[model samples]
Target chain A: MRITLIGSGNVATHLGAAFKNAGHQIVQVYSPNLQNAALLAYHIKAEAIDDLQQINPNTEAFIISVKDDVIEGIAQQLAAHDKLILHTSGSTDISVLLKYNVKAGVFYPLQTFSRTKELNFWNVPLCLEGANENIFKIITELAQTVSNNVYPVNSAQRRVLHLAAVFACNFPNYLYSIAQGLLADNHLEFDMLKPLILETADKVQQQLPAAVQTGPAVRNDETTMNRHLEMLQNQPMLQQIYQLLSQGIIKMDKGTNGKA
Target chain B: MRITLIGSGNVATHLGAAFKNAGHQIVQVYSPNLQNAALLAYHIKAEAIDDLQQINPNTEAFIISVKDDVIEGIAQQLAAHDKLILHTSGSTDISVLLKYNVKAGVFYPLQTFSRTKELNFWNVPLCLEGANENIFKIITELAQTVSNNVYPVNSAQRRVLHLAAVFACNFPNYLYSIAQGLLADNHLEFDMLKPLILETADKVQQQLPAAVQTGPAVRNDETTMNRHLEMLQNQPMLQQIYQLLSQGIIKMDKGTNGKA
Candidate 1:
């Protein structure tokens, strides 16, 4: 299958290479920045184009792997296209592309992409949605070329998944930054906490997160929690996070125990 | 060195096994519960004892690996003996052990311990503190038997490390739980986010967490953040978390960019 990638950000760069590696031809790479477009295109053996007017009309599918906000505007520009049009976004609605293109669908991959890192697309779940059954089948077939885990997730469900990703991926990474800051302030190295962080993640693979949870919060150890709160007196943001998250964990455990 | 373990909980069991594996003789295993003592002792080829009075006076070191609150009581109980006494706790002060015994120290390992899991103690950082310089060296030597990563951290520094662990290890685990709950509510498997979570952690190893952060919060994309908050309207605890963490990330990015 021939594919044209829209955007040259982390997601687009990774997906273009992934599609190319899976025996599909990436016909063109498009980005507002010519350098980014050319770099991605060179890696994927595709033509680099800075303008939507230069996109090949004969490409089998155009993958708009841009930001969520820019997606509709790009779709409007390609409204005259007769081939399949898909945007790789989790939060945007499939209907956004319905009136703009003849064949429209969502080809959202549920994974965090880093431009320099090579991801095994096989394990990343592909959440696909379409305006119609024919488009859905075509998108699923295209998704199956790279991933074994593919689901027909609607717009609403995809939004929920995106929200969950904010908690699981985004917020936790920020927490790590906070932890690093705390350690650095104390003249300690961040690498000291790496093993603990890795093990915390690994525990979730085998046990329920609630069941595996440990610390002052879940244990209801008020002494340690108070001490931690006192330690963070100067940093209001971290103090609030520590308080709110601890309260949430306490509440979660209480709920698990069938209590108010 | 001959060591006697004064608890059969997760930390005690794992540390006892680790110490025994490092060529130290585990003289005895003591626990209030006979079954727990027996279980841990059986693994380490040590005598199982329920009573503190039955503790071997000849043991070179007594490791009190119990709950933080119980460490003081256990230290008081073992004060009559002249052998070195050490308690494994992160938050508890080394001074708590100082008054009760002539030879008191801390042998706190900075890692999450689960009794069912076998951990590589070599990688786990052992935070050591002593009542005096002689005791510090002795505890450090014993710690070096099992782990290469041993630090002479005082009470305040260790307390800070403990607080950091709560953020890096404990809170992230809770966030994973929240994400898992959200997915489970939507009939989506938690496995879908495993790769993303792993990558999020892996990224922190090489890059500063602040530099690698990506999400609506960091991007200052209020639209996606507001959408996520709306999706979590029913979950007040999660809603609070989402708001506070997103605000925190936005603040962090602003701080990084040299803005007020």
Candidate 2:
């Protein structure tokens, strides 16, 4: 498939490279910033375009991999291309694709893309949706070229998946940052917690995490909880996070429907 | 070095087996529960003891690999022997070793250990603390035999490390459970997020996490946030979590203090 990648950020840079590696030709790379576009275009043997109007008429698919908020504007700009136009987003509506005259769909790769880290795109779940059956099939084929896990998730389901990803990835990192802050404030190494983090993740593959939950909160070890709280006296927001998350853990253990 | 394992729970079971693999003679395994002691002892080709009185007097070190609350009680029980006793804990005070007249120390492996998973002991961080230089040397040597990352973390530092571990491991898993719940409620497979979770963890190893945080929260996209709140209307706690965490990310990105 001849692809035109719009947006040269982490997702575009990595996915474009993967698509190119999979023998797909990236005909053009589009970014408002020429440097960002050129960075990815250079890797994929594609021409760089700073304007959506410059998107060649021949590319099989135009992937709008820009920020979610700017996606509508880009889609409007690319509405002329009657080629398949897809946006790589988990949270936004698939209807945003309809604003463009092209065969529209979503190509949300369910993975955290970092420019520094080369990722295994094969494992990423590509949640795809399209306006028509033929378009869906095409996008699904494009997604399968890069990933083994392809799901025909509609906008609503993809939105839920995006929300869940936040809980799993973003929020967890925030908690890790807080942990780092707590350790750093006390003059400690962040590396000490790496083992624990990996084990926690590996456990999910083996067992239900709720059943295996441990700590002062799950054990209801008030003494340890009190000590931990006392230690958090310096940071009120962290204290709230610790208290709320602990309560949430306790609630989850009891099979209570708690906050997400 | 000859060693005795003084407990038969997750930590002790894994550690004893690893040491046995490292060609150390686990002279004896001690536990109040006869069956538990016997089970571990058999795995390590060592004798099982039902009481503290049976702790072999000749063992170079007895790792009190028990629960945090039990370390002091076990130390009191071992007041008879001066043999080097160390508790495998991150949070417990190193001073607990002082209760026994003999040499004492800490041999805390800074990793989450479960009897089920096969772990490479060489990757585990063994945090050591001892009453004297010779004891420290012996414990450090023993630690190096099993692990690449070993350091003499003080009691205060260990306490902070353990707290940090809760954040990195326990809290992250709790957040993962929350993700699982959210997905399950929507009849989605939690497995779909595995790549994202692994990638998120992989990011911190090489770069700062905040530099790559991408989500509706960080983007400050109120449209997605509002839709998410609606989707989570049935889950009030998750709704609050989504709101608070999104707000926190926005604050963090805005270069403002992430206060309540």
Candidate 3:
């Protein structure tokens, strides 16, 4: 399938290159910054366009891989096009492209993209939605080209998934950072917690995380919890995190005991 | 080196069996519960003893792997003997063993232990401390036989490491549970999140987690944050966690920008 890449940010550059590798043709690359567009297009063997006006009218579909806020503006700019169009976003609605005469959909790749690191797109959940069945099928198949998991998720469900992503990915990783900061404050290497972090992730693979919760919080060992809090005296943010999470764990533990 | 396993609970059963697999001699297994002692002893070709009074006093060292509060009581039980002893703990003090009349130290394994899962002992971090230099060296050698990482950390340092473990293992896993609960409320399988969670952990191996933190929190996109809070109202505990962690991330972002 022929695809026109939109925007040259981390996600666009990585996905465009991956799509090209998977035997799809990248017909063109567009970015407000001409140099970024040219660099990415050059790597993917596609034409670089500095202005939205340079987008080919004959291209079957245009993937608006731009940032969330700019998505609707770009779609409006491309309103003259007649082909199916999709914006790769986890949170935005397909309605963002409503002003465009072209059919619209969402082609969100639910994974973190880094410019320096190449990711295996397989198993990355793709949540796609379209205004019509034909556009939906196209976007779904396009997502399936690189991913093993694809879903016809509308904007609302995608919002929940994105929020869950924050819970699973961002919040947990930030907890890891708090751990690192605590270790750093004591002149210790963050590497010391590496094995524990990996194992905590591995455990949920076998059982529900709630079923396997441990530590002072779940055990209601107030003494240890108090000790830990006392140690976090200098780090107020971390102290707040510790208190809130511990309270949550204690609350859940009570629920498990049918006391709630 | 010959090892005598004490307190055949989760940590002891796992560590004792791993030592046997690694070709070390586990000469004795001790537990108040005969069934647990026999079960651990059976796996390691060691003799099971129901009472500390029956403990063989010939081994180089005895590892007391009891629960936190019981460490001192177990040490009191072992105080009647005259041999080198170490309690496997992260938060307990090495001096707790000195109350006994023999060479004593700490051999704290800095990893989460589950009785159901067999662990690679070589990956466990054993932090050892002793009354003096000579006994500390002996404890280090015993730890090196099973694990690659060993530190001569005193009680204070071990306390810090244990606190860090809570952040890395316990809290993040609780957050994973919250994410699982959120998904389950929508009838979504937590399996959908496995890829994203794994990738989040993998990214932190090479990059500072603070640098890689992404989400509405880091972006401080109030609209998305408010929406998430609204969606999470039914889950008051999880809602508190969401608010605390989001606010923490915002503060962290400010710190990085030199605005604090």
Best-first order by lDDT? 1, 3, 2
Q: fnat, candidate 1?
A: 0.69
Tens-digit lDDT string for candidate 2 (A149-182): 9998988889889889988998877776767666
DockQ measured for candidate 2: 0.54
Least lDDT summed over 10 consecutive residues: which range in candidate 2 chain B? B251-260
In order, the first chain's TM-score in every candidate is 0.96, 0.95, 0.92
Error of 1 at A249 (Å): 1.2
Q: Which sequence of candidate numbers ranks them by TM-score, best first?
A: 1, 2, 3
A115-232, model 1: which lDDT tens digit per residue? 8667688888899998899889999999999998898899998998898888888888888888888888888878888888888877766676777778998989998999899999
iRMSD for every model: 3.1, 3.0, 3.3
* Ranking of predictions according to DockQ: 1, 3, 2
lDDT values, one for every candidate: 0.86, 0.81, 0.81
Model 1 chain A: weakest 10-residue lDDT segment is A251-260
**lDDT, candidate 2, at A152:** 89
Q: Compose the digit string of candidate 3's lDDT tens values, residues B92-183.
A: 88878887766888888888878887668798878889888999988777778778988778899899999989988888878887777777
lDDT per residue (tens digit) for residues B1-260 in model 1: 99999999989988998998999999999999999999999999999999998988889999998889998888888888988999899999988888775698989999998886677889898999988999999988889999989888889989989999999988898888888888888888788888778878877777777877889998899999888888878877788888988888888853432111
